[model samples]
Target: MIYFDNGSTSFPKAPGVGEAMANLLATSAFNINRGGYAGAYRVADMVLDTRELVCQLLDWDDPKNVAFSGNITQSLNMLLKGYLKKGDHVVVSSLEHNAVMRPLNQLAELGVSFDAARAEVDGRLPIERVEALIRPETKMVVLTHASNVCGTVLPIEEAAALCRARGLHFVIDAAQTAGVLPLSMKKLGASAIAFTGHKGLLGPQGIGGMLISDDFAKELEPLISGGTGSVSDTEFMPAFLPDRFESGTMNLPGVAGLNAALQYVLKTGTAAIYEAEMALSGRFLAGARALPGVRIVGVDGLEGRVSTVSLDFTPAGLDNAAVAFRLDSEHGVMTRCGMHCAPRAHKTLGTFPQGTVRFAFGHTNTAEEVDICLAALTGMIKGS
Candidate 1:
């Protein structure tokens, strides 16, 4: 199958990811921190190595501040719910996925409020508009590094600078840009960055984390309270970096797979991956533009975007879902259709209710696949 749904979850995950998980389950799948044996120590060491790898990838210094969760959704919950109190206000972009919007919505009902900096029709969130939304009570500014629907890379660096100058905590949801884009926590001056393993990281699902600064880490409270295996003597969660937030037996096998996947990403370099995926997107865009009645969503060019491209076939009298169905069932081209869990983003891009067909290319996709997809689209449009 020709997979163009990498924005949802990467397929054919990094080499050795499956093997690493299998090896851990087969040989030494011991619980770290709790188990007091040699196998447990070895597992714990691997976990530490994984944390350090995350730091290396994000250009962070403190491995201790790295905290893991089931996914970025959970990580965002931990960070948002933990840090923001009843009176706190936050600033966000209109292009946020449900991951960010849902939590903030839940917070709004509890007296915490948020404002969305409007994005342009092409899905670009301008820096000046974002600056205007930051109120005196705004405690933090959260931004998705890129849009999941249209793949428009947001102005995270500019927002970070704004937040830094205003003394507001800058939080980044790097769900879309983590593996495909070169991100430096030091350079961005972000308080925390939440990332998922399954998307751009090319790792297995159920493993994601956050790299938090020391000051922000101290301010954020733990959403969950339980034994961290480090401080079993007391009922209170340990007042430390990771143990403060990580409560329960962690996903060791997922961590193992993510470790292997991260190693592959580091070796392959994000610059090379970005170039390869963008080349595929560029080809697809050039061909799609030539198709009659086909509307390319978002920037319509390669600038300030990732490999994800959304198409509106409404002018051709084609249903988005129907197109996606035919692409999968007939042409063997897999793409995602609908709002992509970002209603706000859809509204911003003016694709609300009637969502576009999204084709998200990955490093594993090729020029041949793009050609096949283009041919499939051509045939569908011509009623052949």
Candidate 2:
């Protein structure tokens, strides 16, 4: 299949990812930070290795500040719930995914307030608008590193600088750009970054993590409360970095795979991946531009985007879902349709409700696959 649903979860994972997971699960998968045996310690080392890779990818200082979780959703929850409380004002970009929106909406019931910065139809968020939204009551700014719907890369550094100047927490949701875009947690002055392991990171679905600065770690409350391996005797949750947010048994095998996937990303470098995917995306947009009734989204210069690409052909009266189903069934082209769990982003781009057919590219995609997608789309048009 010509898979293009990578925005949801990356397909064709790196060569060693499956091998690493199998190696651990077949031999010695153990609950991390819980067991005292040497085997458990060795298993825990894999988690540390993954965290180290994440730190290096994001240019973070200490690896200890990274904490493992389920996905970007859980990581965002940890950061949002941990930092914001009653009456805190938060700033969010208009391109945020449901993960950030839902939690903030729920928190609004407790008298918390939020102000949304305007995002252009091209999916880029204005740094000035985000800064302008900052008030004395603004306690945090949560924004997507890139729009999964349109592939627009937000100005993380500029926003981070504003947050720093105004003394507000700068948090980034790196779900779509974790391994596809370059990041510098230290240089950008980001207080925290939440990322999913399954998408651009090329890891298994069940594994993800969040990285935070020491100050944020100190002030951040624990959202998930329970046994954290350390201070097991105490009913109170531990007040440490990883132990603070991480609770319950960890996904060791998935993290083992994550370690290998991150290794692949480092060996290849995010720059190379970005260039490759941009080239592919450029090809798609170019091809889509030539066709009649093909509405291409996010054709902005390769400078401010990730690998994701969205297009619509609703003039043909075949909705995104119908086109997606046809692509998978007849043309062997797999893709994601509909709002993609980001209705607000779609609405901001004026593609909400009806949504758009998405063709999210990845490192493994080739020129031949692009041609296949183009040819398949053309065929779909011709057959109609």
Q: Return the TM-score for each candidate structure.
A: 0.99, 0.97
Best by lDDT: 1
CA-lDDT, candidates in order: 0.93, 0.87
Q: Write the per-residue lDDT of candidate 1 for residues 264-320, one digit (tens) a residue.
A: 999999899999999999999999999999888899999999999999888888999
Candidate RMSDs in order:
0.7, 1.3
Over 4 Å off, model 1: none
Off by more than 4 A, model 2: none
Give the per-residue lDDT digits (tens) of candidate 2, residues 155-188.
Answer: 8988888889888889999999999888888788
For model 1, what is the error of residue 23's alpha carbon versus the real structure, in angstroms, after optimal superposition? Answer: 0.5
Error of 2 at 160 (Å): 0.6
What lDDT score goes with residue 366 in model 2?
92
